[model samples]
Target: MPLHPKIAEILAILPAPPDGPLDPVAMRAGEESQVPPLEQRLPLHAVEDTVAGEVPVRIYTPVEAEAYGLLIYLHGGAFFLGSLDTHDHIARNLAKETGLRVVSVGYRRAPEAAFPAGLEDCYAVVHWAADNGEWLGWNGETLAVVGDSSGGTFVAALTAMAQDAGFDRITHQVLFYPSLDLDFDVDRYASLRENAKGYGLETGILKAFNAFYLDSGADPADPLVSPIKRADLTGLPPALIVTAEYDPMRDEGELYGKRLAEAGVDATVSRYEGAGHGFVQHFSWLPEYHRVYEETAAFLDRRAE
Candidate 1:
């Protein structure tokens, strides 16, 4: 399918990335400046900032929603960027749309804290939420995890870790155009080439994120670093993986869903036509933002196929 007409306009109007190596720090500032002011953000029931297992997290509660379960959100920004504040509107709207209490993790970013550091923080917050469900007014027991881009990488690895660590608390997993595989150099997926550049997230920039994400000696192919490297996907939580038609990350996300279903996990993959990476974040031009919310609510509620 061709790019959405609006998407083409978005791409045309957007500035092209620098031709050289992208600096994580510079990119962070550029992206952070784009966040809408608080008054312009969605009106939620109540939003609070608190610590969950020593990790800072922002909690958003929906108005009169006491039945829906709690959700943990990990925002996208490759790995070096993104924060609770950067994605405040998203978390707020997610809670409102899904009618669930949302805990947005402010995990440590890369080129500073590195890989496991961020992942550990996300897991710690989940543990804290499970232990303090009553205090957060959680429905209890039903805990779902959602992430986009690099954060989605954490969600995938965290599920496997939770299983191995005997933390079988996550009931559902949702990934938004996730970068499941860190091995970006491989030609394992066609979208890497088909939608590599000029569709929003350029190929060079993505490779740069991959380069900065890992500071350790661990290979990019490690299962913990790249969840797609994990051979056995059995026993993982049910998943709703959303991928965009023109996004470079599309193939791995869809493939992950296929692998999950093959491993007997209940997994559904939805490709939003004429869309690309991070389409749900933009509300001014695309309706996919609301579609994401509706789809997620239905999936989390087990009311959709």
Candidate 2:
């Protein structure tokens, strides 16, 4: 299938790749350029809440009615970059489309915080949301965890941890083009290494991010570091896994979805033929991105009912 016309146009307009080594500052600026201006959008309620100590969150509520469920959203950045502002559109779209309240976490990023630190922050937000459901107008019976890329990695780990600790409150888990495996030997990585126009994820860059996120102290194969390595995929909430045809992480995301299904967990996996890893967040520029949200909202709606 050919790439969507809108996506193709955006790709054409994107500036040529930077000349120097990829540093955090350059990566941050590149990411910011891809995002819409924050002030031009409708404001989400920003709150300072304690999840072990004061953490900030931007909460989006559907205009239709009080939400029947809450989505604790973690933004994607390969564990190193990105912030609440980068994912603001996604959070708002999910809330408005699904009629669910969304609480987007601003977890600590890497180099400053590594490995389990960001994961733990996401977990803390989930715990906090579950504990404060009523006050937040969430039904408690229907709560979910969702993310993309590294954020999806956090969602997978958080789901595993929540299940192991007997926190069964999660109704569904939604992963969009997730980075489920830290190991780089996958065939998809080799096959898509040169795909420059789709989602900007390259094999070399992914390897670098993995090294930074794991640091020197942790093994890359550790299940927490790579959710696909986890032994028990049973007993987690039902999941909806979305992948893109050209994403380097596509195979791993599909494998994780299959693993969940094989473990007897209810899971549905879908791969968009010409889509890329960050499509869900880029819906404003690429019309096809809207389909991802519709699929997610439909899945959540069924789970809620």
Candidate 3:
């Protein structure tokens, strides 16, 4: 199928590629320019809570009293640039759609804090949400984990760690166009590299970000570093994995979903044709994006029930 018309138009308007290597600063500025301004509405309740000694998190609760499940979301920025502000719209939309309280973590980014630091921050927030669910008027046992792109990488890692560490509070996991493996040998990457507009993610830029985020001491194959490397995926919560038809990460995400199914985990994987990476964040601009949001909400609602 051809690319969506709106996406094609947006791609045409993108600025010229940078002459130098892509750094965190450049990535942040590029993202801001491409995306629309985030909505300024305040979270129903924004509270700073400490996790794992001193890791701080900002939790956003929905206004409705209808007791929805808790969704602990980690924002995507290739482990470097995203913040509560950058991903605030997503948190708000998720909260409103599922009637779930969305707790968005301000996880430490790299090159300052590499590999495990960002993952640890996300883990801490999940643990904190589970421990203090009732205090925040949420059902702890009904907690879900969600993320996109690099954040999806963390989500995959955290889910695996949670299972290994006996953090059984999570009931579901959602990944949108997730980068599941550090190994970039997949055919999808090759396909993307050949077509300029096939994938929004630049291969070289992605490689650069991965290099900066991984630590010298970290093994690329560690299940905590790459969830797809895990030997056992059993007993993990049911998952809803969304991918883009033309995304470089598409194959890996689909492969992970397959592994989950093989391990007896209930998983639903969907790839929207004519879409590329980061479509979930553009729900307000694209009808296809809105369709994804509705599908995701329906999936969550059914699972929660």
Give the C-alpha miss distance for residue 195 in model 2, angstroms: 4.9
Which stretches of candidate 2 lie above 4 Å from their native place? 33-35, 42-53, 64-67, 186-199, 216-218
For candidate 1, lDDT tens digit of each residue in 126-212?
888888888888776569999988878889989999999999889999998898887776487899888887788766567666776
- Which residue pairs show collisions in model 3? none
Q: TM-score for all predictions? A: 0.94, 0.89, 0.89
> Which structure among the candidates has the greatest lDDT?
1
lDDT of each: 0.83, 0.78, 0.76
Q: 118-225 in candidate 2: lDDT tens per residue?
A: 888899888888888777888766688999888898899899999999988889999988888787764545434545335556665667766667773445678877
- Number of the predicted model whose TM-score against the real structure is largest: 1
Candidate 2 or 1, higher TM-score? 1
lDDT of 1: 0.83
In every candidate, how many clashes are there? Answer: 0, 0, 0
TM-score of 3: 0.89
